[model samples]
Target: MARVAFILLCHKDPDAILNQVTRLTAAGDYVAIHFDASAAPADYRKITSALADNPNAIFVTRRVRCGWGEWSLVEATLRTLQAAFDAFAQATHFYMLSGDCMPIKSAHYAHRFLDAHDKDFIESFDFFDTDWIKTGLREERLIYRHYFNERSQKRRFYAAFALQKRLNITRAVPTGIQVMIGSQWWCLRRSSVAAVLAFTRQRPDVIRFFRTTWIPDETFFQTLVRHLVPGREIESRTLTFLMFSDYGMPVSFYNDHADLLLGQDALFARKISAEAHRLKQVLGALYASDRTDFTISNEGRTLFSFLTARGRSGRRFAPRFWEAEASIGAGRSLLIILCKKWHVAKRLTAAIRQSTDIPAFDYLFHEDDTPLPDMGGIERSLAKRGRHHRAFVRMLYDHAGTDRVVICLDTSSLDLLGDFHADRADVRILEIDCDLGDDYLIGHAIRVGLAGPQTSRDTFARLLPTIRRDMIHERDAIRDARFKNAARLRETATDAENAAALAVFLGVDDTTALALAQTPHLFVD
Candidate 1:
């Protein structure tokens, strides 16, 4: 097996840091530490003294006074990578991690997995295409310059932000480089690390451009890897599991996440706070055992159940589509009933099953008031506003790995047509009309149930045309909206304010404003 080098960055939780260092050292892996300069000298010394006897462990002498969303983080990581490469010349891979991160898989299993795969494990996504930060809008981070002091002074940061906005001194990325954003953590081959380091050394201009950019640490390496490396050799997935809150902050793992963490194939999990003493203990015990077969405890199962229920009720995104899909079966057709009326949904489900012999299929009713079974179904909490229908659509396509999905929604749920435009081939929508004299079904599957039971294969054949027409109309509407919004913004602003206002209107940064303004649909919809 190839030796793995771990580059850890830490500022707080000295004890947890030492434990991580000790664990990696015990696994016969090289460990490089980059303690924040603002951290206490006593804490640094404590970490250093604990690893004094381990020749494989080395703390970089050059430290950084790191601040959130600052270039200092990138500099510190580059320095640590260089130091690790210098110390362990034969190491095959470099894993960028944080002090709060701990390996979930055994060292042997991780090494074996890495040895078998030639590709680098780094999550990189086109910034314009995906919501990397889950901000609902994708381009805000790329457009604005976010400045924070070393101690995270909110007032100072906001004041600077407002000043920049007023003065109209917008920051721009380097020319000819497409912005790519992803999780900061990654596992890269040694050659890839070297390539990144060489690119930075050769392009000092790129470094300077990103220095003023917000959250450069997340974008810098990702942009380089996408620009420099072959796309085929990069697997766009991180090996670490980081649970994020609705506000985009990384949440600390607790005993409740034990089953979730244990079930994941990711090698590491991160952002473990010092307060989670019991979680740390459980993880430590699990990692210390040599046995590969482990079972979730009764308490873990109970906690998982509670968390699963809470996750569905919460307004945030919940990824239960896979469990729902699996409970039904693979290859089984899925009918997602998005109607608010329970009787309407029941009639639709019954009509579909009675009318068609579409092989094995299951029904998942999504309603606000009617509570469906936890398994093979989803029920929205009545107290909360439900705007996460798009998230549910995304989960079906992106997470659940379902190829064929039929959505049966009422006229009120027609707003969800926007989500099916991109994946119309894989998804079909049946717009059911509850009124007696109106067209009963008005989507891809058009059926006029006002006269008689219009349930047949020919009725289903008209679905694709209706769907195509709806998709085209929706797309055109979105295109027109973007154009009108951009035009309105351009007309209302003065010459000095046009660039900033245009960027805001287009939902992109000034660096991308010219290109984005020309193609407003790329960023807006």
Candidate 2:
């Protein structure tokens, strides 16, 4: 087996970090961990003590108080890489990972994959070609110097802005290097790692230049690798899978995402929290299983195809709908109410129209029969309730743009409008806040058949807490049935039974279903 070096940068969740270390050590790989200097000494001690018996595990002493978007992240990574290289001279590849990351494939498979490929596996793209440029990140992040301290951030930002406006300071690309940006996670050959370290050492000026630049972690390694190996073929795929929210924060995985994670080609998945104990255990067991073949099964592939088609359809329709809305000009503030109960929607719409002027608003009810704007073949693909809601919101944003305010009234609109929040600042989300007693609410739901006739008073009483909780938390029970079912299964079923049930439910093989079912229900409110 080819030796691989794992360089992990961890700050919080000592138990999860320890579990990762234990698993890596068992895989017969060298593991070097760099705990954030800001982390508690107890945490460091707990992790180190757990790994004391393992010869392959070593703690990187040269730690830094790593701050987000600061130079400290690069420094910690360099230190960890250097330590791994020093400790494991026979290692063929170096894998940079976070404490929250878990291997999606067996270690043997990862080693074989790396040994078969000569090119570095790092996601890189031209800096100017990225979406960040459209968001003015070029001016706010690259052109100006941002101070690390929170107290001085705003002051330095405005000062830099004023200076740029007054002096027209054109930020130049670093000497002898074209700018490249990518995900921070990467898998590189030992030779590539050595070359990167050497380049950083040889050019202190390059380090200094990126010191004040925002999120240098995303660019530093990418720029260096491209600069050092000018003509080398760089693979634009990172081994790690990270899903981001519309707000740009990584969406942490839960028990429900196990099937998706297992089907992915990525060797590793990140941002796993300790609270996801079931997920941690499932991934840990897979890592220890030593199964080399990580290919997606036929069922997984079919599901992937379906999801991909749905995504493509959504992308196609969203822009076209936006264009049509734009052509019509800003007509009126869109009032969208998504409710299955026609009576409830009618009552709410009437009350709002009576209290406020209806002439200024265009009322749209989101129901099964509601006709979506004709988008050629794309309109046929919006059969799924969730997808329809998401597409509708995307169209509304595209039509209204950022200038006009869109008022949304839906129990499930918050999640449907997730991707729109960052871009659609003009959207005003309003929920019907009711102060009616539980008896009234239960009676109403019963009348609407939302609650079954067989549901007894005692059962309703037990459900009151859930109702109150949902009210406060803004839960969409109908839309979140899968998650709710998973939570209920975790409480009621054995791990093996849960796995079997999930396999049948998700149409996945037993292994994939087991992986997901074994994960802890960390998403429970």
Candidate 3:
């Protein structure tokens, strides 16, 4: 007879399971172990042979094949729980655990805690009413029939789901039960286990309903235990500490994570790395110690570290897919002049070139498909600006004698703007909120003879405000390299205003900026 009986479900790493069993039974707690049938037969033989003489350890008679996101895992758990429930008649509680789990507190403390509380420690909630399902299907998981394995046959699984959805086929929930969802770990009172087993015997239909349920192991015991135990007797929580990554995958604990695992508020920590031998040995020694369960503590330093780490991090600069010559971007600084009008960009390029020794290019990404500046000697097709956009741009830094180059861009190159302006380290954005109502485009088109001077300006000026607001929003919404680039942008309703803002952006004198702005016509062809 023991205070708590543990039902341990394990697939791989029989050595780890054996260690857990030996530790639990040594503290006078019963452990019923189940090895997944899909695993090597020799792993089962290994554990059974190791614990051949221990009376507190009993191997479950039934073995089942289990798969991820399938119903067989729940079957494995049910068999393991039944073996434990039948073996330890006088045990006060049954704790469900995985082989990856390690006790956070000494067995004596856990035993005493169960006796004091007398509550079932299980997480459960009404599935139809909660925001708990974060990544996958919530109602669709239950209502539809899944004939394909989601893990192994992703294409078939999706096809089946699509077919069911298209056909509008849905199954009803088993009668008289409110479906519940929770973490797949729990510790239940003896009476709770008895109630679950009784339900299994009386309601084979419900069991059948779950056999086709997706990830039933997460829902089965949680739903039943909620129905079986009274409200006051059920604690809506788990005794195990587990965490997931931002991508929803389980976060594995390593030897370096020993301190963090020890500091968790749970009585057990799970999904420990199988390769974490040092961590396992250190935690395994706790079974002999007299430590009780601890409160999460007032360690301001540790909490501070966690809060700081968990807080929103600075957004990363995504270099475009030109992977081969990415290193060239670091060779020199880049200033990209962005404007919605071709005339404005042309004017800015001419102004920057005349006022500063820095080389400037006129609309490098323009659709005209001209050769890149200083690359006129290369073959026309190879040197076309759009052929390898990012690579060709990055390579220009190597040819520039100075440390920086100014490249002007207009609406024709809007797609490149998204990728070009994103590099926070080496690239600075000079966005000209140039005059939207300027007739310079019409004037330039007439002078160039593209149209017969009868072409009217489109309604782009009416939409410029929203575009500007959206640009500011985009900058504010994304995290910077850590912060925004200094003095990188400006707005202007006239040439004088453009000069003032450009003076601040570039460290040029106000007089020089004014000259550059006023004398732009000197270089415009």
Give the Cα lDDT of each candidate.
0.61, 0.63, 0.70
Model 1 lDDT tens row, 347-390:
43443334333221223323454423232243345222233443
Q: Write the per-residue lDDT of candidate 3 for residues 1-525, one digit (tens) a residue.
A: 237788888888877788888888888888888888888999989998999999888887679888888888888888888888888887888888888898777776677677778789998989999887898888988898876689899999999899989999889999998899999889988888889999999999889888888888778999999988898998898888887655777777778766555555567887788898898888888765778745443222232233334334333334445643444355466777766555666766776777787778766666455335556543245345555666666667667657677777653344455566554327665665543333444443334333222232232232234334544444443323222343433333455775776676565788887776675352232
lDDT of 2 by residue, 65-160 (tens): 988778888899999999998889888889889888988777777778777778788877788777643333663567666665433476766676
> Which parts of model 1 are misplaced by more than 4 Å?
136-140, 143-151, 273-275, 285-525
Provide the lDDT at 11 for model 3: 81
lDDT of 1 at 235: 92
Runs in model 3 deviating more than 4 A are: 293-295, 298-525
Worst 10 residues of 2 by lDDT: 481-490
The true-versus-predicted C-alpha distance at residue 273 of model 2, in Å, is: 3.9
Against the true structure, candidate 3 has what lDDT?
0.70
Clashes of each: 3, 4, 0
Give candidate 2's error at residue 232 in angstroms.
4.9
TM-score of each: 0.59, 0.57, 0.59
